[model samples]
Target chain A: MRDAYHEELDSIGEGLVEMARLVGSAIGRATTAILDSDLKLAETVIEGDKKVDDLQHDLEARAIALLARQQPVATDLRIVVTSLRMSADLERSGDLAQHVAKLARLRFPERAVPQDLHATILEMGQLAQRLMAKAAEVIVTKDIDLAMQLEQDDDEMDLLHRTLFQHLIDDRWKHGIETAVDVTLLGRYYERYADHAVAVAKRVVYLVTGEHADDLQQDIPPVTRVEGA
Target chain B: MRDAYHEELDSIGEGLVEMARLVGSAIGRATTAILDSDLKLAETVIEGDKKVDDLQHDLEARAIALLARQQPVATDLRIVVTSLRMSADLERSGDLAQHVAKLARLRFPERAVPQDLHATILEMGQLAQRLMAKAAEVIVTKDIDLAMQLEQDDDEMDLLHRTLFQHLIDDRWKHGIETAVDVTLLGRYYERYADHAVAVAKRVVYLVTGEHADDLQQDIPPVTRVEGA
Candidate 1:
């Protein structure tokens, strides 16, 4: 019975890693779709999200069933509970990716991102993918240091997010209100995708260290309040 | 022992209701602060969020302790687990309200919503407050029908959100990009606040009927995809 319980735990970890991989690919493709205005690729990412959703649902059921049957205590209990949260974070990350894809689809033949801003959006997307990959690594290896580093990595994404906003608010911005809204929402999607990755890493940090990440200084600021201007 | 367990469960329920009430008020005041450009009220909302955070931490600890100690199974187990999720939703709702307040603070003497849009934003704020109040009512009464109603309430918020964007995209939009960004973020904060309220109510519906809210038709559209235009 104990062996079987450990097996279930291992499977849950694998599920998280799989989810991370899927969502990582999703954001990457969604980015290319947006940058290149590839409607077909955007549609693929949107449809692919269902797979991520199904994985989360299956993982959640197994975790809950384990809780009911094994009645795990101590670290084992924390593992199950935290996995549930990590699954949620990954699921949300997938949804964010899907939102990016939908934005690409909405713009259709017209590019949502202007030519000058393409590089920044591409970099943001790459950073988001890397963060989720690192988050998955933290989960599988339970590497506390790697988990801690994910927060710092998120700072890069935040900088990119701010850069996007700065461009929009600049007097030189020629994009009409419609495109401005598109860019704003797109920046938010990538920023939030990184945030969910950081959240997953923080949960891993807690699982390994038994210390809540909130007790530690947060690397990323909670709210991006515009300074008095 | 059973009575003691029941008492603990009741306390958790009450904690959720209290959280709902606190966040409900926070959104209301945050709305007023933005509309009236009241820095003091915005500061109060920002500071008061700490209370909501502390309450959530306390509630989470209590819930986890109960789970470990009582080893609750079946419906009792569902109650504890679902309460944790609902607490999280409510806590996030508080953060959304704080974001609104922070935006207000950032704007300082200037109103975030233009005079023309003020009525719409005010209605959105009031709708948010009513939805949360209804969510709190559902928590206390476990009235599945009332729980279901909160989703429809959220639809009203989505409509308001859409209207705001329409105004921004219209050829008549004379507001600068900065104001447009402010309005966009503000509309999102209120929309998300209503979403969390609906999420809380859905959790109640699940607790009562053992039916997942996703199985029901979603009241608000998942992604705000613009149709071909």
Candidate 2:
């Protein structure tokens, strides 16, 4: 009976890893769809989000059931509860990725990002994807060092976000108001996607160290506010 | 002993109500700060977020302790777990209010919102505050009907959000790229604030009915993708 109980717990962990992998992939593809203006890929990323949502729903139900049945105490209890929080972060990350895809679809047949800013947006997207991938690895391996590294990556994500905004407000920007709005929203999507990824890794660090990550301070956007004229 | 356990549970519920109240007040003041360009008011909202965060951390610790010591099952278990989630939503709502205030401070001595769009931004901010107030009421009363009412209010928030965007993309917009970006982030901050409040209400509905509200669908931003030019 104990074996079966712990097995259920193990499965919940695996479910979270699967969710991380899916959202990581979604953000990557959504980035490509927007940069390359690939409607087909955009649609796939949007459709794939349901899977992440379903996985979260399943994981949540199982975690609740495990808590009830095992009445887990100490570390086991924290792991179950923390897994629930991690899954929520991953699910929200999936939604952020879908937002990117929806934006891509909205601008279908026309590239959403302007020509010169493509490299920056692409870098932001790729960095966001890598952050999630590393977050998943942290979950499985419980490597505190690897988890700590997500902070630096998040800092990089913040820098890329600032660069994207610089392009938006530059006097020489040729893109009209509509494109500026798109780019601004796009930069936010990528930056927030990375934040969720970093949040997921932080939860793992908490689980391993038995310390709350919130005390460590979290992601701060690179630019605090738009520069006044 | 059981009586004290139940009292502990009641106290967690009260903590949530208090957190909700703090954030509700914060958003109203934050909105006033930005619209009036009141640096002191903005500073108040910014400083007040610490109280909300402290309440959340305290509530989380107490709730976890209750679960561990009491080994609550069935409805009691659900309450403890759900309270944790509610506190998280409220804490995040508090952060969103702080974001509005921070933006106001950043553009200090000068208004962040343009004169023409002030009315729309004001409306969004008020609606956000109202939604959270009702969510606080729902937490205290466990009124399913009142909790259900939040969905309609959220729709109004979405509408206000849409109106703000329309103003942004209009051909007549003369605020330049920097103001446009500020408005875009401002609109997003209010919209997300409202979503978190609605999420708090939905969790109450779930607690009462044992039917997941996510199954009932959640907020769809008034504008899903920035409109294509």
Candidate 3:
């Protein structure tokens, strides 16, 4: 019975990994669809959302069942809880990607984004997607360095987001009220996407370190120690 | 050993309830301070934040210890996890209250708010504070109806938020940018407070029903059903 329990637990981990892969694919396709203005790809990403939702529900049920039947100890409990949280963040990330794709399809050159802004947005999307993928990598491999690097990657996304904001606010583009709303909502979606990735990274760090590292204060460079000091 | 574990768990619950009470008081004091421009009450709310923080950290430690040592089963595990999530929401609520106080103190009134908007804001504050207080009440009393009421109460805050936004955009006051920023931030804080309360209510519903309530769908008015149907 114990052997069977362990087998069940291992399969749960496998399910989480598979779900992460699909989520990552959804994000990748969504971003590509936005950049390429592919309506077909946008529709595909939207359709894919139901699968992610189903997987998330399945994962939650399995985790609860493991808790009920296997009576997992401290580490196993933590693992299940972390998996559940990860699934939530991954699902949100997928939603964000779909949101971005929907915006792309809705606008389709009608929104009149500045040409130069597209490169920055594409950069932001790639970085956010990579950070999410890295989170999954850390979860599977327990890679501390990879997880640590996510914070820096997120900082880059933040910088890009600010730049994108500046682009929208500039006088060169006389974006009307509706277009401005579109841009504002799109920018918020990207920023929130990056935030969910950061959340995933923080969870990964906690799962690996077994200690909360959520106090990663932004922008205030931590007082560095000198050798003499 | 088992008896000691039970004692500690019970104490953790007590601490969480106390934390919730502090958060509730902070929201009340902050809202009053903002509405009345009472600098003293603002200071009190700010000073009260440390207690919330301390309780939060203590509860986190206790929950972690309980999980590690007690190895609790289904219901007990749910209790510990619930405590952890509750403390997080409570801590955030306290932080929002402090933010409102800070904004109030920053823009100490040279004059009182115009009567109409003042009444609206006061209404919003009361509703938000009441919802937060009821979150604690429902948790302690296990009153599912009270929790359900909070879900309804969130819509009031939402309506007020919309009204405030519309009034601001109308620009009747000719308020300067700083004052506008203050009011906008204040509105956001109240909206977030209601959001946290709704979150807590959802948790209660989950605790009682063993199912997640779709809060968005819950907004739909129920129609009469024929017994034959």
Candidate 4:
């Protein structure tokens, strides 16, 4: 019975890593689809999101089943609950990628990204992919240091996000409002994608360290404090 | 013991309603702050979010404790797990409201919404608040019909979001890129806030009916089917 329980836990972890990989490929393809105006690729990425969503749903069900059957306590309990949340973060990351693909499909035949900003968007996409890959590694290995580094990696994506806005906000901006809206939404999608990756990594940090990432900063009190009424 | 467990479940439900009310008010005030350029009001909303955050943390801990102590099965287990997810949705809604307040502070003294779009934004904000209030009602009453209605209400927010984009995409768009970005982000914040509200309502639907909200839409298949290996 114990062996079966451990196997279930391992399966959940594997499912999360698989989800990360799928979403990472998704953003990469979605980026290329936008940069190259490949409508077919965008459609493929959009459809592929169903697989990620299915994986999340399956993982959640299995986790809940394990909770009901095993009645896990302490660290084991935390593992199941946190896996549910990590699955959610990864599922949302996939949705963000799909949104990118949908945007690409929306502007089909016309390049959504202008030539000058293409490099920044491409870099942002690459950074997002790397962050997810690292996030997956953190889930599998439970490497606290690697998990901590993902947040810093997210800062790079943030800088790229800001750069995209800088281009839009510059006085010399020539992109029409249509392009501006497209770029604004695209930047936001990538930024949010990176954020979800960071969130996944943070969950791993908490799972391993028993401390929330935010709690480490000490800027605010611990999130779960029970006081006598 | 059973009575104690039921009371704990009721407390969790009440906590969710409280969270919904706090977030609903936060968005309403944040909207007013932006529309009126009231910095003090914006600051108040921003600060008040801490209370919402703390409440969510407390609720999550209590729910998890109940799970551990009661080892609840079936509906009871589902209730605890779904409450956690609902709490997350409400907490995110609060964050979206805070983002609105922060943006208002960022553009201090300068109005975030232009004179022309004020009515549209105001309408979106009100719709978000109303949707959240309805979500709170759904949580307390577990009214599947009302929960189902939230998706339609969310459609109004989506339409308002589209209208903002239409204005931005028009050839006559005179708002500079900075204001354009601000407006774009603001629209997204409200749109996402409504999405979270709908998510909370959907959770209620699932909890009551044992069917996911998406499953009701025949366009998509059930989200969790494992293929033959």
Candidate 5:
């Protein structure tokens, strides 16, 4: 009976890992769709987001049931609680991706973002995706070192965010206000995506260290300080 | 032994309520500081935020200790978890208020935001504080109706957010791009403050209903649609 119960718990863990993968992939596709102005990909991401959402709800229900029935203790309980919080963050990441897809759909082939800013956004998205994957790997493999490294990965995203903001403020492109708004919002979304990825890493840290690391100094160190104007 | 444990839990719950009250007042003071350009009030909020942060950490540690020592089950476990989550949200709300205070500092005596926008911000801040207060009330009383009502309150903040965005986009002010950025950041901070308040209310919902509320949903009933550009 104990073996069977352990097996069930393992399956739930696997389910959470799968959900994280779907969320990570959705974010990547959504980012590509936005930058490339690919409506088809954007549509695909929009559709796929529902899967991420469903998987999240499924995972939450499973975790709650585990807590309810299994009466998990210590590390097991922490894993269940972390699963609940991580799933919420993942769902929000999916929502943010949908927001990006909607932006792509609304603007379409016109490419609301200027060409110069695209590279920065692309880099930020790539960094976010990588960090997310690392987070998932840590969850599956229980790699505390990888999780620790994932925190530092946010530095790249913050750098890209700063660059994107600087471009928005710069005189080039005749200071296009509308695209600037889009760019700023996109930067924020990517930054937040990376943040959620770091949050996953923090959970892993807690699972390993047996201490809550949620708000203990953000994963992303300051890449560049914004001088108060 | 059980009686002492219960008393400790009660004491912790009381402390959470007091922290909530402090957070709500901080929001009020921060908003007043913004509107009145009361630097002193802003400074007070900034300083008070550390107390909220300290309280948040204290509450989390206490909750964890309770869980570890008491091995609470079912509804008791849920309450502890809800309190933990609610404290995190309240901590973030304090951070958001600090962000608003930072905005106040940026404006100095000049008042970067126009008088019209000021009223909108004040309204948003007031609504957020009220929701925050109600969240604590619900937590204290386990009042589902009050919690549900707070969810609806977030709609006003969303509407005000959109209105503030439109005003910024209208570019009626001659203060130039910096003004726009500051206003945008200010609006973003207040909008997020409202989001945290909604988050607290949602936690209350989960505490009562054992299910997370759809936080993206603004108003509860008629689905009042705000015009989107």
Candidate 6:
């Protein structure tokens, strides 16, 4: 049986998974809210961000307290420290989801996305939500393969983002400058959301393998150095 | 006499200050690069970001090692954790600066900011750099009042951001949709740069006061709770 101290450590990791789940569902619902101009759903997502923030703050306080009380070293120390970083990433992801919902609220009864672009925006949203879901799964299972997969999903997100820009710059666009501005901002919100999800997965990879994801991907050895005096 | 352990903690804080200074100068140069379409200057900013990343990785490793070796409690512990967070903010701020430079490089000989909008963009860039300088100052001094001042600067940044949007949506916008897109992204990069700078200052305030900046901002007493079983 695990001691109480270890249980506390386990709880911090569990909190991260729960936070990721909340945000993953949030992006999915937030995407629907924006596309449909559902103010009610948007309101819930915006209000729900507080719960994510609170979880982070609580987890942070507990993590520090654990360090003070338990003083676990080596791998245990790395786990607690990494958990803090993961929580920060998850909290930021929640904020990005809220930004999407807030944009929906800003547009009110009117749709934020233009009709022709809705399909692309929807695809971006769905892909972003999938990325976050997989990130959460990686957190739970610590499967390095699952963590690495987020990069390809992010590349897909990038392709969709480029498609969005192409549509914007195309001469066929009949939308006014205001609509284009909204669309531009919306595209950014989704892209940044996906980036954060990928970052979370990378952190998991680092924790599991003791190597940076980019270093592993590019076959570059991480340099070892002592800080110069 | 202060021991080696405390000196190590002091060095971590110093490293953060150094990072803030590097990225602060980067934003200033990137602003010039974009305004003048100077590929050379933009290249320097892009390459310099690697230095910022190196500093962060080195600092993080040292921090984790220190946590393992020192096992600080209470205020000392908070300082180390907050340093790690502040380093992350500075590193991200560096990336934002590099994004500004990349935009400049992408636009090449063509200025990204059209003739009419140059003043606003320049102001945003200057304000972002100033915010980072002040944030660095706050990290070193931990002056509560100086830390509080970042909020006002951030407010100014938001106003500038809105002005950029206004220019984009102006009925007389003759620069076409492509320029509008570039301007929109530029505004976002600057605004986010300022936000990260403000975040760095707020973390310093949190470390010094043991109170969250937002909690203090609105006079909201932070809630106390015991985790439910």
lDDT score at residue A60, model 4, on the 0-100 scale: 92
Put the candidates in lDDT order, highest first: 2, 1, 4, 6, 5, 3
Question: Residue B65 error for model 3, in Å?
Answer: 2.8
Alpha-carbon shift of residue B77 in model 1 (angstroms)? 0.6
lDDT of 6: 0.82
Question: For each candidate, what is the lDDT?
Answer: 0.86, 0.87, 0.67, 0.84, 0.72, 0.82
Q: What is the lDDT of residue B137 in candidate 5?
A: 87
Report the number of the highest-DockQ candidate. 2
Chain A TM-scores for all candidates read 0.95, 0.95, 0.86, 0.93, 0.92, 0.91
lDDT: worst 10-residue window of model 4 chain A: A220-229
TM-score against truth, every candidate: 0.96, 0.97, 0.74, 0.93, 0.88, 0.92
User: Which residue pairs collide in model 1, if any?
Assistant: none
A115-195 in candidate 1: lDDT tens per residue? 989999999999999999999989888898888788788877877888888898899999989888888778877887898
Poorest stretch of ten by lDDT in candidate 4 chain B: B220-229
Summarize candidate 3's per-residue lDDT along B109-159 as a digit string, tens digits. 642244557877788788887887788787777788888888678877777
TM-score of chain B of 2: 0.96
lDDT of 6 by residue, B1-229 (tens): 2499988998998999999999999999999999999999999998998899899999999999898998988999898888888888888888888888888887788888898988999999999999999999998899889988988988888777777777777898998887887887788778878888988899888888888865311110001000010
* Candidate number with the higher TM-score (1 or 5): 1
Clash pairs detected, candidate 4: none
Model 5 chain B poorest ten-residue lDDT run: B220-229
Better of 2 and 3 by TM-score: 2
Over the stretch A84-190, how does candidate 2's per-residue lDDT look in tens digits? 88998899889889888888888888888999999999899899999999999999999999999999988888778888888888899888887888888888878
- Give the winner by lDDT: 5 or 6: 6
Q: Which regions of candidate 2 are displaced past 4 Å? A: A215-221, A225-229, B215-220, B225-229
Candidate 1 wrong stretches, greater than 4 Å: A215-223, A226-229, B215-229
**For candidate 5, what is the DockQ-based docking class?**
acceptable
